[model samples]
Target: MSHVGKSKILFVDDEEVICSMAAEFLEMQGFIVDTYEDSREAFDAFCRDPDDFDIVITDQVMPKMTGIELLKNIIGIRSAIPRILCTGFSEELNHKDEKEVGIDAFFMKPYRFDDLIGQIKKLV
Candidate 1:
């Protein structure tokens, strides 16, 4: 099912290529996406418009704030928004613990766009 015009996503990653690629792909799929390479900046943007996005997708290993840290701050502001954490360091994550901390989904790095879309569809 196409979420065309139905959802807006806030996506953050420290990697420029990943951010650009994901944003491009998501936009093509008809979902409005705001991409950021800086976690702090992304958090600030989200804070300014907490209700603007339907979902949050973030990379785990960022410079200033980790994905988990960002998600924590996000949920503190608006607990209802669904959060997805993407990371290359799977071993660093404790799935059960992350769920407790407010992550609704996880995407390992180098993931297929189809899988990401499927997870997004599931969440909203």
Candidate 2:
């Protein structure tokens, strides 16, 4: 499937392999995807210039900062931007975290590529 508008997406993960794979998949699905290995840079991009992306998908377990922290800071700057927190945790645990951040979605790591695409589609 292809997108109708320019739905820019940012994928943040400390792991290059995971980000690379996901980035490629998202691009193939017709979204403008950018991958970042550093959470700090991703945070800066989202906070400083949220107009650059339509949605953000970030991994939870990172080196310097957690995804929740990054999302928190970004939400402070741009409260309207949509966000997705991707983690290895179950949906039950994610639900507890959801109350605070108000994310557009919570995606588990190793998630199905098609399912991820579906989530993005719903948001965009």
Instruction: Please tell me which predicted candidate would have the highest lDDT against the true structure.
Output: 1
* Backbone N/Cα/C clashes per model: 0, 0
User: Could you say which candidate leads in TM-score?
Assistant: 1
Query: What's the CA RMSD of model 1 in angstroms?
Result: 2.4
Estimate the TM-score for candidate 2: 0.86
Clashing pairs in 2: none
C-alpha RMSD of each candidate structure in angstroms:
2.4, 3.0
Looking at candidate 2, what is the lDDT of residue 32?
88
Candidate 2's residue-wise lDDT over 1-124, tens digit each? 2245458888898988988898888888888888899999888777666777888898888888778888888887777777888888563345555667888887777889889889988887
| lDDT assessment of candidate 1 | 0.88
Query: What global local distance difference test value does model 2 have?
Result: 0.80
**Candidate 2 regions off by >4 Å?**
1-5, 90-97
Q: What is the lDDT of residue 9 in candidate 1?
A: 92
**Tens-digit per-residue lDDT, 68-91, candidate 1:** 989989999998898899999988
TM-score of candidate 1 on Cα atoms, chains taken together: 0.91
> How many residue pairs of model 2 clash at the backbone?
0
